[model samples]
Target: MKNISLRAGRFLTLGLVLTGLGLGSCKKDDTTTVYGNWTQDASISAPRSESVSFVINNVAYVGTGRNPAALSTNNVYGDFYALDPSKTGSGWSSVTPMPAAAGVRYGAAAFAINNKGYVCGGYGYVGTSTNITYLSDVWEFDPATSTGSTVGSWRKVANSLPTPLSGAVAGSIGNVGFVGCGFDGTGNTNIFYQFDGTTWRTLTNTYPGQPRSGAMSFVVNNQLYVVGGTNNNVATTDVYAYSTTSGWALKHYLRNVSNSTESYDYSAVSRSLGVGFTVNDKGYIAVGGSTLTTCYEYNYADDTWTLKNPFNGSARNNAVAFGIGNYGYVGLGYTGATRLNDFYRFAPNDAQQ
Candidate 1:
């Protein structure tokens, strides 16, 4: 009988051990599968935040932002630089600066249509730090006339936006550019307008989503996806898609709003001033609102969110991002009071870092 008892004890111990291993396997299966990779790239010419970036003729132009070193003096920049991704080493080259008559500004809206880049409304302190001036001027940059490394010239577009706005977002489809959703000093607005390479006209159709400021947009399959920003001083997770054919339709929110529990908590995706870009037909948002490094990717086909590797950079907001050829590039923003000039290239389907 004593020998029987000893055998029973051994069997019980083995059963418990196997059960524990099975539970451990289950936990491993539940672990989030992180995707995407980030590698440090050549930094921009200067550290800046609240800057404007647009791609013209497959070349990216970045310029016009606040100078962190002289924030007390309200120092803003009008200088522009062109970055060629195909080139090795620092890809940045100097270009003709934004015209001073347009006012050195930050938080301006920019878009490229038909190989011409346009800069729209922004606000500046004018002369005194306390006296702010909101502008409704539009400037166009044509690089075709440029020879080699020399960028082209800036000419003021005859028609300005109907109203002066800062923190607006703009995107272009073919020859038409769409501008919408920003703070007009007094309040947040939902108005959208279209520029047909000539005149700016208010679209009678309105976006069904909430009006937001500091939002970012990226185009995929010719559809513009507007994602993340603030509404009435509160960060929002709303995502909306707009096209000339469909007007507007609500898409998946930044967070996981489905009934299933498969998706990890993505509460961090709701923030303003994040950089948005499209890579391989997928839209991505990275680093914004109170110094964040988290990144999220949107699958346009699935209308779902996937967790990408967090940005491998100093936590920041108001940085700029643009896609050239196959990869997406992000750079230039402030961390606390310190401005950053570093850049990173993102590979969405690469092994997670």
Candidate 2:
């Protein structure tokens, strides 16, 4: 009887050890699987594209996109919605619209500085094609007051450079805003400009990539990167980086591992015409034509591109994306024939997959 009891104890110990080993293996696999993926958290009702979205104080604000019905009409939306990621259930609420009706302008650029959000440079119409205007105007909105004062309103910044341009990508470091390559109403340009809150200065270094529109640009590690865009509807897979002292240089070419010939084009979407941002030291590209929901991530450390889970909400193009913390917010844009108002949050996790 004593011998039987000893055998039973040993069996129980062996079973527990095996169970622990199994669980450990499972956890390891899960962690590895989800290391670089984005999971959809909450969806908000935000319909419109060619709009702008940005995050301030852990909450996101989305507003001003083209109206769904009259695609050509320059009716800018004034409705402002706020998103709180920490809140459960419904996470978005309407705050206040802009003071006046701005016009419908796709490809406008937006960025935040000192907690204030600025919307700048896009094409819109006052009445006709003759009246169809490209604006170099800039507007400032403060989330704290939930108010917009076009008080300092539209100032023409680029005097020495080309005429009013749209589809320009912009990124801000400190109080300085950098605008790079885009369409100047007639053709794509490689011009680079910097705005020091009060004035604009054109940088002499020309970007090496082909003159293209709709490319994505972002700054990582104090270096600016421009990725896939279109040259007259021809999509490019080239990626370039620029530094203040070094000028523009090629980083890596994004090649389609699945197809050597296939390339990304007008499909590339930036926060503006050419905008990109860094999250977790990895760069994420969201929203583009041809492949709307498609999302790609770049590991700067490895210089490799990995296709992550596609954006879970409406597949769209010409939308805007901004990062607040661990999550990235995307909203507004055209999904094929229809304009979208839905908002989505992408959360990157380290937990087991």
For TM-score, the strongest prediction is 1
Which stretch of 10 consecutive residues in model 1 shows the poorest summed lDDT? 1-10
Cα deviation of 235, candidate 2, in Å: 1.4
Q: What would the per-residue lDDT of candidate 1 be over residues 1-353, giving only the tens digit for each residue?
A: 00111110012344446777884234433244566678898877778888889998678999888867565324678889888877778578899886656668888899999889999988775433455577788899998776355678888999999998899888988788988888887888888889988899997768877788989889887888888889988877788898889788887565544343333335657778788898878888888887788777877786766667788888888888998877888899888888788889888777745
TM-score for each candidate, following the candidate numbering: 0.86, 0.73
Q: What is the C-alpha RMSD of each candidate to the true structure, in Å?
A: 9.4, 11.2
State residue 160's C-alpha deviation in candidate 2, in Å.
12
What global local distance difference test value does model 2 have?
0.61
Q: Residue 278 in model 2: shift from native, Å?
A: 2.8
Error of 2 at 283 (Å): 1.0
Candidate 1 lDDT: 0.79
Per residue, candidate 2 scores C-alpha lDDT tens digits across 62-93 of 66666665545545554566777777776667
RMSD of 2: 11.2
